[model samples]
Target: MTKLTLGVSSCLLGDEVRFNGGHKHHRWLTHTFGQYADFVPYCPEVAIGMGIPRNPIRLISTDTGTRAVDSMNLTDDYTERLQHYAESIVPQLDALDGYVVMQGSPSCGMERVKLYNKNMIPEKIAAGLYTGVLQRHAPAIPFEESGRLSDPNLVENFVQRVYVYHDWRTRQPWRTAKELIDFHARQKYLLMMHDYPTYKRLGQKLSNLKDIDNRGAFGQAYLVELMAALSNIPKRGHRVNVLQHVMGYFKNQLSEKEKASLIHSIEQYQASEVPFIVPVALLKHYIFLHGDQFPYLMNQTFLNPYPEELGLRNPI
Candidate 1:
C-alpha cells in the first residue's frame, strides 16, 4: 500500500517553529508513525511572517469577537493571517488522509486551547484558529492531537481511520457500481465494529447508489457519514459482537474442543481478563487453518486494520 499523506504540526516532527525557538519533538510520532506517513508540516504562527522566538499569541474574546492576538500586546492580531493561510493550504492538501496537531496551541490545537477575556484572563476553551478552518474545509479527514496519541485506544482508532481513508482515496472516481459495492463490502466488518446502526444505514444507502442521479454527490455523502461513524471508538460490546459474528464462519469446521476454546477466549475478552488481541489472534489462527472454506473472512480488513507491529489492540 502507498504511504498515507498526513498534515502535522511542524514542531511534532522536531522542527523549531515555536515562538520560543524550541520544538515539541514527539519521539513516537517522529520515529514510529512517521514510517507510515508522508508528513506535510505547517506552523501558522511562523508561516505568517512571525519570527522565531516571537511574542506569544492567544485566543482573545471580547464584545467584538474572539481574535488570535499577541499575549503581551493585544493589538497585534494575526487572526486574518492565520485564517487565510489555513484556507489556502487546505485545497492544496486534497490527498491528505489525516492530520496530527499540537495540543494547547493558539493556532494549531485541535481542541481546548485557552480563550481569554478582554481583561486577558483565561475564560473558556476553544479550538485553535487554523485548525478550526481546516476541520471546516475537510470535515471527513481523520484528525488527532499528538498528546492524545499516547492513549492506546485513541491511537488505534486514529490509525484505523487513516488507513481506511487512504484505501478509499486510492480507488477514486468509482465509474462502475460494482467497484463501490465491493469497497463497501470490504469495510463492512470494520464499520460494524465502530457503529452497527450506521453500518446498516450506510449499507441501505449504498444499495441505491446506481439509481442516484449524481454518483459523485452520493459518494461524498456516504464518505461523510462513514467517517463520522468511525469517529467513535468501538466499545467492548461492539468488539464482542463482531468476534462472535466472525466465529460463526467456522461453525462447521471446528471440532467440539476447538469451538470450546474459541468461545472461552471470547468470553475472557468480554470479561476484560485478556486484551482484544488474545481473541483476535485465536480467530485469525482458526481462519488461517480453514481459510479456503471462508474466503470472505480472509478478505475482511477488520482482521488486520493496520500493521501488526504497531500493536494497537494489545489489550494493555
Candidate 2:
C-alpha cells in the first residue's frame, strides 16, 4: 500500500509552536494517524523569527467581513511571514493528500478566528490567517480542524477522503475493471449521501478507461472525473442509504431475528443520529460468529476499516 502523507500544524504535534509557546497536542491524532500516515508538521510563525513564547498575534480587519484581513506590524507582519513561508513550502502542500489545521489560531485556525478591532471595540468578522493561505495555495487539498475530528463520522469522512485520494494517485498508472469495481464498492455508500447521478456518471466514464489506448491521458481524465464524483459531502438521510447498503452485506449471514434487530437499530440511528456502530457491531458480531456466510464482504474495503473506524459499529 502507498503511504499517505498529511500536513499538520506543528502545535497539534505537542510542539510549543504557538505565539505564547503552548502546544495543542491532539491526542487522538498522535495516537491514531501517527501509526499510518507520515505527518509533516509546520509552524509558519516560528519560521518568521517570531520566536517561540513570543507576543500573541491578533486578527484585525480595517473594515467589514468583505474587507476583513490579517495584518500585523503595520505591514501585517504575521500574515506576510506566514504567506512567504507557505509559498516557499508549496511543494510540501502539493505532496500531501490532506491537512489538519488548528481550530482558531490567528495563524492556524480553520474557521471563526478572532477578529480584533484596531482599538478597544471588537469587530464582527474574524478569519484565520493560515486558513486563508492554505486555501489559496492548495485549493484542492482537503483539510479539517484538529478539534472537529472528535466526531467519529467526520473523522471517518476525512480518513476516507485521504485514502480515496491516495488510491486515485496510486492507481494512476493503470485502472482495471477489477480496480474500478473495488473502488466503486468502497465509495458506494459514500456516494448515495451526496449525489447519486454524479456517481453513476463517473462510473460510466470509468467503463471507457479500460478500453482507451492512451494510458496517461486516460488516467488524468479519469482522476478529474473520479475525484469530482467522490467528493460529495456526506449528509443526513444518507444514513439510511448507508445502513441499507451495509445491511445488504450482512443480511445473508444474519438470522431473521438478528436482521430485524439490526434494521431497527438503523431506524433508531436515522431518527437519532446515534452512532451507526450499534447495528453495525451487531452485524459484525454475527459475521464473526457465523463466519461461513459472508466471507468476501468481510474483507471488502467498504466493510473493513471505514464505518468501523468512523464509529459506525453501533449507532451514530
Candidate 3:
C-alpha cells in the first residue's frame, strides 16, 4: 500500500525551527505513525522568514483586526507575512491526506490561539493564522494537534480518517455507478460508528445515484456527506451497537454458547470494563469462522482500521 502523505509541523519532528531554537519533538509521531506517513514538515515562522532564536510572537486584537506581532516589539507585525505564506502553502497541500499542527502557537495553532486586546490583554482565543487559512482551503483533510493525539480515541479517529481519505483520493475519477456504490458499501460500518443518522441519510443519497445526471457531482456530494459523518469520534455505545448489528448477520449460525460469550464481551465493552479490542477480537473470530457466509462483515473497516502495532483501540 502507498504511504499517506501528511503535513506536520517541523518542530514536531525534532527540527530546531522554533523561535527559542528548541523543538517540541513527539516520539510516537517519529517512531510509529512516521512509518506509514510521508511527512511533509513545514514551519510557518521559518517559511515567513523568521529567524531561529527570534523574538516570540502573539496574536493581538486591534481596531482594524487581529494581528500577529512580535511580543517584545508590538510594532513588528508579521500578520500579513504569515497569512500570505499560509495562502501560498495551502495550494501545495492538496495531495496531503491530513495535517498535524503544533498546539498553542501564534502562527500554527489550530484552535484557541490567544487573542489580545489593544491594551495587550488577552481577551479571547482563535485559530492561528496559518491553520485558519489551511482550514478554509482544505476543510476535507483531517487536522489534529500533536497534544490531542495523546487521547487514544482521537488518535484512532484521526488515523482512520486519514487512511480512508487517502483511499478515496487515490481511487478517484470513478467512471461507473458500481464503483461509487462499492466504495460506499465498504465504508458503511465505519460511517455508522460516527453518526448513524447521517450514515442512513448518505446511504439514501447514494442509492439514488442512478437518477442524478452527473456522476461526478453525485460522487462529490456523497464524499462530502461521508467525511462529515465520520468527523465526530464514535462513542463506545455507538461501537457496541455496530458490533451487535454485525452479530445479527450470524444470528442463526452461532450456537447458544457462542452467542452468550459474544454478548458478554460486548456488554463488558459498553460498560467500560474492557478495552474496545476485546469485543472486536471475538467478533472477528466468529466472522473468520463463518467467512463464506458474511462477506459484508468480513470487509468492514471497523475490524481493523489501522495497523495492529499502532494499538489505537487497545486502551479504549
Candidate 4:
C-alpha cells in the first residue's frame, strides 16, 4: 500500500514553531503512524509571519465574529492573515489524504479551541482559524486533532476515513455508473456498521443512476455524505448487527459448535467483555475458512478497514 500523504501541524512534528518556541511532538504520530504515512507539516502562524518566541495568540469573540488576535494586544489581529495562509495552501492541501492538527491552537486546532469574549472568559468553543478555512474548502478530507488521537476509536475512525478518501481520490471510482455501483458495493457492510440509515439512503440514490445528469456533482456530494456518515463511531449494537449479518452468510456451513462459538463471541463483544477485535478476529477466521463460498463477504471493507498492525481495534 502506498503511504498516505497527511498534513500535520509543524509543532506536532517537532518543529519549534510555537509562540514559546516549543514543539508538541506526538510520539505515536511521528513514530507509529508515521511508519505508514508521509507527513507535510504546516505552521500557519509562522507561515503568516509570526516568528517563533513571538507573542501568543488566541481566539477572541469580536463584533464581527471570532478572530485570532494577540493575547496581550487584542487589537493586533491575525485572523485574516491565518485564513489567507490557509487559503493559499489550498492547492497543497488538496493532495493530502488527512490532517492532524495541534490541539487548542489559535491557528491549527480542529475543534473546541477557546473563544474568549471581551471579559477574557472563554465564552465559546470553535475550530482554529487555519483549519476552519481548510475544512470549509475541503470537507471530505479527514481531519483529526493530535490530542484526540489518544482515543483508540477516534484514531481508528480517522485512519479508516483517510484510507477510504485516499482510495476514492486516487481511484476516481465514480466515472461511470457501473464503477460507482462497484465502489458502493465494497463499502456496503462498512457503511451499515457506521450508519445503516445513510447506507440505505445512499444506496437509493445510486439505485437509478440514469436519473443523474451530473456525475461529477453527484459523486462529490455522495462522498461528502458518506464521510459524514462514517464520522459517527459505530455503537456496540450496530457492530453486533453487522457481525450477525456477516455471520448469516455461513449459517448452513458452520457446524453447531462453530455457530455457538461465533454467537458467544458476538455476545461477549455486545456485553463489553472484550474489545471489538476479539469477535472480529474470530469472524475473520471463519471468513478465511469459508470465504470461497461467499465471495461478496470476502470483499466487504468492514472486515479490514485499515491495516491491522495499527492495533486500532485492540483498544476499541
Task: Give me the overall lDDT of model 4.
Answer: 0.89
Task: Give stretches of model 4 more than 4 Å off.
Answer: none
lDDT tens digits, residue span 1-316, model 3: 4788999999999999999999999988989999999899989999888899999999998888888999999999999999899999988776898899999898889888888887777844789988998888777778999999998878888899888888788888887787888888888888888899998898887787773458876776776777778878888788888999888878688889989999999999999999889988998898888756778777777776777777787755
Summarize candidate 4's per-residue lDDT along 1-316 as a digit string, tens digits.
5789999999999999989999999999999999989999999899888887999998988789989889889789998888888899988876889999999887888888988888889843899999999999999889999989998888999999998888787777466787877788889989999999999999999997863467788888999999999999998899999999999978788889988999999999898999889999999998999888888888888898888888888654
In angstroms, the error of model 1 at 222 is: 1.1
Best by lDDT: 4
lDDT of each: 0.88, 0.67, 0.86, 0.89
TM-score of 3: 0.94
* Lowest summed lDDT window (length 10), candidate 4: 208-217
Q: Mind giving the per-residue lDDT tens digits that candidate 1 earns over 198-228?
A: 9999999788777445767777788888999
TM-score (C-alpha, index-matched) for candidate 2: 0.73
Instruction: Give per-model TM-scores.
Output: 0.96, 0.73, 0.94, 0.96
Ten-residue segment with the worst summed lDDT in candidate 3? 211-220
